[model samples]
Target: MTEGRVALITGASSGIGEATALELARRGFTVYGAARRVDRMARLTAHGVHVFEMDVTDDASMTSGVERILHEQGRIDVLVNNAGYGSYGALEDVPLEEARRQFEVNVFGLARLTQLVLPTMRAQGSGRVINVSSIGGKFYEPLGAWYHATKFAVEGLSDSLRLELRPFGIHVVVIEPGTIRTEWGGIAADSAVARSGGTAYARQAKRLAEVYELADRPSVGASPRVVALAIAKAATEARPRIRYAVPFGAKALLALRWLLTDRAFDWAIMRAYGPR
Candidate 1:
């Protein structure tokens, strides 16, 4: 039954991270949910999930979080790198500092956490590193240059890490969720409006913002639970797949992107988000 398996999930205060924590707990894992907002994790405690105040962007915070889990549980069987956000705006409009910060959180933070856990996982001779990426990793979108760049990095990083970790019995899995009903969409929309509003790209940026807003509407996108279940499967399955693109349609979109030429794919993306 995989009893006594310990898991550490970042960004577990909400959304996909929160859902995945509960899902793994239900499946008999000793789950520790980590995020900056410990207050948001109160609900998790009721479900037998341990909560840690972890800021993945900070070196000390991440190290301390991992140390706490290791001290309490003795070993971490699974590590979910899910702490990230979308800094949405045209590359020309988004400040270089903000763009760097986005990479710090989305790419460097994930890498830092993975580095901290790999030693322990290697020593134990078995573990799973589940990275929460996005379909944006495979395709591009207007006003999402920084966000997509980070995700694309995640995809490539995961691919290489998977190959390197194979002989050590550590599996690296990437969870590529499509548009999911979460606070993420609203946040991204807000960022786009703030960065590109009243500028040369204002119209298209707002158009893209509308699409992000729609993603957050009830029933408009898949629930976090769906991605959570897929993450749970990736974490527990003996031979987990390399990547999972959730909500079903995401797979089709990825295929379409591959089959179409660059200009054709770009036109389709613009059409989907362009003003009606």
Candidate 2:
């Protein structure tokens, strides 16, 4: 067990983020779990995890949370950029403001938090950044333009960061979670329907929305623990893989994507989510 090492996990109020926070704290890391709904994380506090309110899209909230951690713990050894959500909609139908908000929450917020931690990690010369991406980062789906773009950005950003931070002895790891048991799917589906329901893409959008709803079920998706364990490994391992795709299904999809031609993959996605 690595004691006294501090860890900060964003979006820790629920789902994978909350699970990872508990797992890391159990493994002897001083864990700080942050989220917009602090009340929702009451259970985390009971498990000895430090719970705090933080909105990733809010610069002051993020900055203050990081600074408070540093002030209290003196150091941050792990920064898990796990605060994000899926906003599904047809690009043509989704409002530009909503699209930008998606980026602010899913992409820029993660980047901003990472920027805040880099200096401390560089000073320590030993730190790890774990980004919670998604299998969508590799593959794509209808009505997922904005969501997939953000994840793809995360994938690329993490790759570049690994190289840049190597000299500082900081490791950047991307956690690509497949369908996990979370409220994310419902929210995404609702957004898609709301945005594209009456548009020309309504049928495809509705079909994809059904797919998401089904995929998020307990039997369909892996447990959040699976992702939590993978993240814990990335945070603790001396040399972690640049990417950790949780559960077997995620790996399979990633393999499929790698083996198939771009057009072939597009055909497959259409077969799965296209209007019948």
Candidate 3:
């Protein structure tokens, strides 16, 4: 039944995106993996996943990538909007331009790609839009104002889209992942240190960076495959839920925040990310 179904996954060069591409391909969908690093996805080719050089922040790249898929497959049954990065820094020290770029890739880029694919999905009367959000969407942490903001935007956007598309049989699902072992942590740590390293927040910022860097350790986070499996389930389930938060502990963390008072949450964050 899933033989001819087509899926387009962004940020497919590595991590959850890469894992999802392989998992979906294994399940018999014709998967097209898109990312900025075309060469990094070459390994995906062996798994029968088509690779496209797509920069989600660029309109031209996004448009052409969609066109190529539609031209070849005639329809897209699933779209995983997964291209995003963490711009970790204190709100005061992070540049507005950098913040905009984060939103460009994480929020605006996901929204625009959804817009591009909705028409095709509507024509077919069935499709799934999977936005790769994060647990940060529901909670806050130190040195992650901009990144969390983008994810919060994704959560709201996906919620609204799910309702709007229900009538058309198009389901919008948000996949919220907790700590996952990937280069994402290293990139975020580097950004955190770069923007706030020499400022007054240097000590606190560096401490948070160490926390982020811990993600590289296998024991610190879930494997990318864990999230990938959740994504596959969301895309293929007959009655899929609107949101899937990966790694069972992620939901618990969200619940903890929900139950905690503002001051308590602040204290917890400080204890976790503040200077040791």
Candidate 4:
């Protein structure tokens, strides 16, 4: 473990980000947890995690957060870009503004923060960038078009970055997680319900919302800790894998999708969404 090494994590107020911050702290990494909600992260301070307010969508905020961390720690050993949200609804029903906002947060925000951190990492000649993508990156769903698009972009971005940054001695890794029991499902479900109101796809959207809610129930999904462990491994392992597909089901899903024909995979996905 890199004792005293500094790690800056976004979206650290809850879910995988919160769990990852704790996990990294446990491994002796000096953790700076950034999110819009500072009160929610107050508990983390007790565990030695420094909390910072950050809005990834704002360039000044992103730059200042990195500058503050670099000023304090001198060098950032790891950067975890986990600050993103999902917008779930049918493609046609989702307004272009909302879709743009989704990309603003998921894609542009991530890219902005990465830009802020890269100079320091490049100068140091050693660092890790772990992007929390999703199985949705490899698979698609009716209501997740925009969300999946962002993850797919993340997949490509990380791949290209890994090669480009190799000469700088920096490693870019990705974590593709399956469904995990967290606020993610609730947020996604709520978005679906809101977007479904009065739309032609209302019924199907409602069903999708129910599916997310049920999947998020304690009995079905993996705990946030599962992803936390993956993040920790990516941040600390001597030679971290380029990508870590975790909670088991994600790997199986990716494999099954690859093995099946396009029509067959689409049929399977549709069936899983409930009888059409």
lDDT of 1 by residue, 1-276 (tens): 568999999999999999999999999999999999999999999999999798878999999989888888889999999999988888899989999999999999999999999999999999999999999999999888899999999999999999999999999999999989988998998888888877888997789888887787766788999999999989878899989999887888999999999999989988997766
Please write out the lDDT profile of model 4 over residues 94-144, one tens digit for every residue.
899999998988889998898888998999999999999999999998788
**Model 4, stretches more than 4 Å misplaced?**
274-276
Give candidate 3 misplaced runs (Cα > 4 Å).
none
Give model 2's clash tally: 0
Q: Pairing residues by index, what is the TM-score of model 3?
A: 0.98
Candidate topping lDDT = 3
lDDT of 4: 0.90
What's model 2's TM-score?
0.98
lDDT of 2 by residue, 79-174 (tens): 999999999888898888998998999999999999999899999999999999999998899899999999999999999988999999999999
C-alpha lDDT score of every prediction, in listed order: 0.92, 0.92, 0.93, 0.90
TM-score of each: 0.98, 0.98, 0.98, 0.97
Model 3 agreement with the true structure over 180-264: per-residue lDDT tens digits: 9988988999998999999988998889888987877778789999999999999899988888888987988888899999999
Lowest lDDT block of 10, candidate 3:
212-221
Q: Counting only residues 3 or more apart in sequence or on different chains, how many pairs clash (N, Cα, C under 3 Å) in candidate 4?
A: 0
Candidate scoring better on lDDT of 1 and 4:
1
